[model samples]
Target: MASPAGQFHPWRHIITFLVITAALYALVFFTPGSTAPKLGIDLQGGTRVTLLAKTTNGTTPSRDSMNLARDIMERRVNGSGVAGAQVQIDGSNQLVITVPGQNNLEGLTRSAQLNIRPVVARWANPAFVAQAPVTTAPSTTGPAASPSATATGTSGAASTAPSSPATATAQNEATTPATGSSTVTTASSGQGLRGEAAALLPKAASTTDASTTTTASSPSSPPPTTPATATPTGTTGTAATPTAPATVEPPASVFPAGSNPGVLTQPAGSDEAAFTTWETAAKAYANGGGPTCAQIEYFQGLDVPDKPLLACDQNGQFVYLLAQTLIPGTQISDATSGFDTQGGHGWIINVTFKADGFKTWSSYTTAHYDRTGGTNPPPDSMTAFTLDSQVLSAPVINEPITTPGTQVSGSFTQQSAKSLADSLKFGALPLAFDRQESQQVSAELGFQYLKAGLIAGGIGLLLVVVYCLVYYRLLGLITILSLFLSGGLVYAVMVLLGRWIGLSLDMAGIAGLIIAIGITADSFVVYFERIKDEVREGRTFRSSVPRGWKRAKRTILSADAVSFLSAAILYLLAVGDVKGFAFTLGLSTILDLVVVFLVTHPLVALTSKADLFSHPVWSGLGNVARAGQEHRAVAARLQSKEA
Candidate 1:
């Protein structure tokens, strides 16, 4: 090893530190995404939610599924314009989501499964069914039919059953209370409900002269047709239809009960019987209309996408028999909301599908078009866009959509349309998640915490600087410079880390930084004390600087090693904000080593060599060095006399 006196390349070491610091500053200014250190949610005030994964079959979710769900969830939160949102997998089946400054957790946490399904049938409130006589044209082999008919009900309100699919936002109709006959008007209600009633009743059936009216009591039963009360409209066709068509049977309904609605309650599995029972009751409403408004809202939470569902509008005014999903939300690539200028429609959400989705949607639209194959359109030709079990929009396939854009227009304000568009933009979660825990921090409180931490740190740093200057005199300048240098390095590193790895600085991390000031200051204290001890032992300040550094550096490294090791262990064992504390501690410890070796030691050594600082008063070695000098002179005289 080089002697302490020989290893005096102070300028070289100082140049190295300057170069490193310069490089760090250069990166801070030049690198993209390295603007500033990212503050953690706790410091910035935000909501944190922990979600537990759940499967339909009640099995533990796989790691891959958990990771995928986390990525999608993060994307969703970010897409919703929540800044600094983070999603991290905590365990095999748990996810922790943190959003800075957002309180609306609904759109951030929904399954958001936006599926397109065909409307198999429609059922109005039995109490509100029109009493007016209905008429229809004979079944003919032609592409012509009369215009749509309107049903006037007891409430004197008419709902136009258009051949085109109706938008999700229909007229604000009155809703009946769950138990009584009294009806109330609801202008803003969420989407309809699903239920499990098995009793079938005589539901009123009405249709225009252009349509057929049929009713089925169960999934297995054939639809029963009622005799028309009015004469059919005559139409010209290639083949003339028979006049006596009273005995002809009605067409079969297209939907089937593939799953049980009651499965939503059952933990073991779905019951097809339960689904059949609900289907029967729903069909009673579809065919004749008996379910009260109360029953509609009471059973509205079915989430089975693979089977037909009996659901109602938000107002519980009408129930629709919806077919299985024709296109899943995953096929939707992008969605946006804006005002409709052409049709004067209110705020509308526009969805763009992936290639496969476009093809499937086109085929469904074409197949359901009234002119396709010169046959009447399927009775349930309207397509509904559903999120979970709620019907968002059910519009008729007015024309074949071979391209990408599909508009969902209804009674939407700008807020609602934008909300739905954001939900659809990120697609759906593969696994369902139940929020296990939620925590929120307010901005005011977080700012207070941050202020308190900074004040405490400033006080500590101020005291340290004052103590160094009081005791070490001019040498304290080296300690101050070292502290600033270490701080600069740490700040630059944190900024880069925040940009590259999303490492955020939280309150606990600020505590770590405060503690690090002491750790760094300790190094300077150790080195300076060793130099003072050498001067007391009859050595010159110049020689003592190198010798002191050589001895004290080992101790500095050892102390930093212990600190770093402890931090590493803490980081590995702890979770949440504690990890932030440990990480910052460990990071500062390493940087302390760098500052001690390059900046602190070099500057101290260079100062010791300066003629001005070599004097006892200027060097802060005053009385100790004077006493050593006197002892050295006495010993030299004695040695010369003995020789």
Candidate 2:
């Protein structure tokens, strides 16, 4: 068998290419934004919210809605600064949002209702639209109802011009308060004001009010049918059925708008009318709507400008509007939630249930669905849920929802549900979170980590170089070159990932990159040692290259495979900064395999032809190691044959 002295000549191009690729990635990173890459939250600051999605309509939310929600949240996060934030969806409807704090926290919370709409000259929504709109004439609403309230439009902007009475009336329907007990205030009812088409549709069908009539004899109230049936996480389910999938024909264009984003299956006009009709009927289903389904429940954004709202409650279900979060001084730190408590999952906002809240909830539902037909429900049975707000599952309310401070179960995820409850229970925001996790972030901490990484990496490199020289002697240069090739490739990947995926080199990540150096060198070690072993066994350079490869490949594959598996497992399980470490570790492991196969082996094959192996001084290995039995016995035997 011949030695691998110069069997392959083309490998030089590959090593050069890898080095250049690494160089380009370094260029991409370390540049300014626009030209450079972005960082992650830990390196920056901001609020991160995890929302669990509950399909209000009994089906899973569509991919489009989920993506749109993520996009909208990102917009809200980025709107704070040119330093963009990230919003991504995990699982089905679960969203993870990260925004840089940049010293403004309330600004971040206000962006929470990213799903709210912006339409009409006024904040014309398909919501309550009721009450004596503080600007309008006095209704029988509580005295707290004022006529001089300012109203924000659907887009969350103050309307440019004052709306006409009819316009005000229309816009008022859409304006509801934040969804907290402390935030709920009184307003007049706005149910009967909707178009005739909406009223007629529900009249076409009727449900039994048997649940209400039998309440006196029933031992326990039946629970509402929640779309989320305690299903295990990661379980894929079938699609949902629309409550009132419109059978009506599409209008060509131009119809009275409702809350549903015109992005419907049919034309916007048809969807709009259907939503309006649905709104009217759904309102009836809530408490203000009818006795059987009077009250409707919803989570609202407090910043909506309108005041003393008259909501639409067409059915007999209880209707709720999210009041604003509690004010600071009004909250008590030691407060707790009780079943009798009207606020959050179990928080009391410390404020009394004001009269205004009563009028807003009860009046709307009473006006629409107070009348009962023996055990039979009225013709208009509403399918109650929020228009665009991230509605958890809205259960079918088969009975009148009456009681002060009752809990509205949206069947939300623990996080989102808690957030809604927290907003309601603790309405005040004295220390708005500009940052979810903040550190001193002095030059001391960053520099300390940086200096430590440099020291560790330097020590590692020094050891590899020293060991190579002590053993391989002339061949040590080749070992050093191979190390550089792998390092260059790893560096390139880090820079590219930072640009595309917001990766950072914290302490853990640096540790990962440093650890990879040994793994990479080990591959080269296996090959180098095998070559020396073969040479001593009497093989020539050409044959040893492939022969050495055959012996080394097994060890290389086994070692790399273990490293790759560890990285994959860590990446899946670890959260926060640890993920960065796992990612880098995994990436470097892959690159090491590539470098060993492509650069290290090829260079060795080419260098073998330079006559260094036959000479004592120029070979890439030391005198004692390379000068073993292969030098004396093999050279003597071959010389005799030649003679």
Candidate 3:
């Protein structure tokens, strides 16, 4: 039978270490693609963009707001699968973003300003219309002669108009003119007010003489005392010029007419007379042939949140007349990507609003939707969602979204839906950001830095190997082999972590690994020194190995525990590249304990039984003092204890 001290089963520990090492190697090699840890921006070239925030009030943003924006931007970047992206606030109003690999910089930098507003009117972009071939012949007279006219004719005149057969038929059903009244007819139900058909209604009415009159009235001005009329003499004759009516000024309740360019108010009543007049004036000013860019800029400069806005979609293919803001983007509390299973509309962004947002949304929808519980709602009952002054979507409010919130469905792919959801979930930045700089870091520079780091690490590791061999001599072989095993295990763990958790390795992380070499060596030295002390006190080398391990294990564990605790604290508090250093340090510290107990201690214990350890010089324990004064002293103490 084996002696009690010898029965530690050291071979079992060796087997366990070998098995674990083999398993880790298999995992590292078997993982598809590159098994190396992912590299960060400092080690791998990537794009960097700097943004300067522009506050509405022209003042610097608060530090808290900038930090909040940075955090939100980080979440958005990470959620988009760009892991290890760096977003930092520079000064009070600047943000610097660095991301690895090729990414959508435009999407990353979007303002994501979500605004919900009522749809007053919508028209096909004139540019888009002009690009398509004109199929219908031009009308000879009346509203058809002028693109600026805002009248949809009564049933009789609607037939003679140059509008397509489908348009006339749709308009006839949607609008009904009051009998004997020359005023243009409009749908009382919001659902019926939609598209070109609604816009054509006012133009259609221009065919009648009485309906063509422009009213000039405001809150301060009394109603027109006498109606001015224009009379045409021939079938295509020019109208007899009538006396000009008084200049009608906009009500003070909205714009003061000349206060700002393009500022307009929502017209009241179901007739939509005021909306038609404003639409006509806006189209003439916006679509005039001077310069589309200049026109758009002028309109954008004058956009007011509480007033109606005339803006185009991002593609500029459609223009929308948007009502006052109902709910601002700040009210959006959360957003997520989902599929519209019921409608088979592919992907969509689900938005949740806060309590105040819910109340605002509920009130708006209740006002726009048919409260009579009717099946068909009005077409004008829709709300448009805008980002950066461009309309993203305009969905009709079928019912009040009183639950969590509503969904924004569009012609969206999975990526686009997720991107939009990420933007909305993060909420809008407190201020708009202008791109200050955009540049790409070349891979060559990153590779050069990486090479330098690797060289430094290699040199440090080499010095450690030389020192161990010089000091411990034959025993250093065990330390060297243990280090080799620990290195393999640590590398495999890094690769696995990168594959599973998107952990990226950078220069700082390499420094952490280099530091671990020293830490790991210390544990071996402690164990070996403990064994040397035991031998000097007269215990045989074979018994001293096991006795030394028990004494040294506690010290090893305590030191490693402190190192791990410090690393944990650093990782939790640090940001940017420093986090990489802390994480690697903590990970390597754990693996060091595994290697020490399993590989290093067992090998030392088993080797103590060999003839090499019998000689103090060969065992690297110095003079053992066998049968000398130290041994006699130890023997005397043993005898006294037995007595």
Candidate 4:
């Protein structure tokens, strides 16, 4: 340990380290929000998806299912190019995900309803034997009969039946809906409910007809025969003939439950136009057509009070679509989730309805099971059981349907099928979502804010530079050199902090740097002021330096410690951008001590021996200020002689 009069101080190294830290901070922070690196949503945008827990035979999707679902979803989200996306469970079954620097994303922000739906296709199987259909033709035995002769009351539409497979196919195509029926499949009067439902189906085209599949004739086989025999009555039916009666395309969906855009039109008698029209309407409606998306307006052109169509309900993410015989007072008894015992292998869903449901469903669907109906047009059959004007299933009610909670089955994938089952069991969402706000953000504006910050920083730098020149003169070089060291130190710290602990510098932090400039100057001022006071009292610069340092250390430590404490407290309590201010203030307060003791003191000690500082012109101190500062040894000698 050296005496108080000793020229060198042990605390000097700590000061040097602090100056280096400040310099590092300066370099890193000067880049707008990054003067130190600023963190953003882009670097870390979060993942969002809606989830629906099973309500019926759909068990509340098991915890394991939830976990597995989370894993699968996480994989999908992370795989989609977002790095560092974190997925976490929100509630018992909910999940939340986040990433960095993902500003203004156009992501589908709806709850995820993963499911496996069976691929449903129309097949004209032999009523006698269940056979897969190769084409749309309902291959029967002999004389091509009118469509009315086969299935009675088939959607209450009039048309001739095809006894030959080719003609049956043409009838299927003729029955398909046309125009905007997809959106407006139903009407209030229910005058021809089944006719409308039939209209929604695709005109099953036979290989023999050009109207069947949209392809040209390859003159190989004979053209398909459509019964031109006027059905006992009168009505013109357009039929498609195929050279080869084969199914080259999928049959139109019968009950393709989709959004209804509130308007749909049916072309007069074209199979192609009718099928295409239905497709358009079902896909356009969203959110159950309850209310319009803020971006899309709500427009309900058709609906009835007796049988109102319900969109996605309380649990909007889930939908309850039933193909049961319509029952007005059916009460639900029980419901459960499909089991995935082998870890998501085969899933099956179940639901049970009350006794009343069993009775109503039986009556509502089987009213026209075997009954033959009258058709004013050429040949007609009663149409039945359609949701959104699309046939879900059209098995002629051979017998009354009596079972409660009837099971619906077809080609379903694991996720889609399960999702549908859950929705049917859980029901719809209660409230509707209306977009309250929608706006686009610009990086350009962010850059402008950054520019304003830089300008302010430049002004602070100029002031610090000028003050040092006028007050310290040649000695002021210590301030300039110390600032350079501080800037480097601050830069390194910020980079490491951002990369490791997620520290960032914002506008507030920039302000802290500016304020820090003054704090550093204060430290130097304290030391220089003390030295001047000592010299005015007749002490030499050497003697005054040690005394000045001793006194300034306590004041600097006390002041800086307060600043550090305040910053720490603010950082702990503040949210968002405010923390940036606290972080910079704390960092700069610490570096202030570094410049004063390390660069300022050491340089002053070495400069005391130089002629430049000793000479009044370079030192900037007047005769009055320099006093005995130049030769304090003479005072010491005279005092000793006097003693």
Which is the leading candidate under TM-score?
Answer: 3
**lDDT tens readout by residue for model 1, 392-473:** 5454444455556666655676666666777678667777776788888665347788889989989999999999998888
Task: Report the C-alpha lDDT of model 2 over 22-137, residue by residue, as the tens digit.
Answer: 56765765554334223334443445555655442445667777776555555444432223355677786566665533322233343232111111011112222221121211
Q: 27 in model 3: Cα distance from truth in Å?
A: 11
**Runs of candidate 3 exceeding 4 Å displacement:** 1-104, 133-305, 312-317, 334-352, 358-375, 379-381, 398-427, 430-437, 441-448, 459-505, 517-565, 571-576, 586-642
TM-score of each: 0.45, 0.42, 0.53, 0.37
User: Is 2 or 3 the stronger prediction by lDDT?
Assistant: 3
Q: Is candidate 3 or candidate 4 better by TM-score?
A: 3
Q: Which candidate achieves the best lDDT against the true structure?
A: 1
What C-alpha lDDT, on a 0 to 100 scale, does residue 288 get in candidate 2?
A: 28
Candidates' lDDT values, in order? 0.61, 0.42, 0.61, 0.42
After superposing candidate 2, which stretches have Cα over 4 Å from the reference?
1-9, 12-16, 19-444, 612-614, 620-643
Alpha-carbon runs more than 4 Å astray in model 4? 1-36, 39-444, 626-643
Lowest-sum lDDT 10-residue window in model 1: 190-199
Q: How badly does each model clash, as a count of residue pairs?
A: 10, 89, 19, 102
Per-residue error at 434 for model 3, in Å? 4.8
Q: How big is the RMSD of model 3? A: 15.6
Which residue pairs come into collision in candidate 1?
A: 165-395, 165-396, 178-294, 192-312, 193-300, 194-299, 194-300, 203-288, 203-289, 204-288
TM-score: which is higher, 1 or 4?
Answer: 1
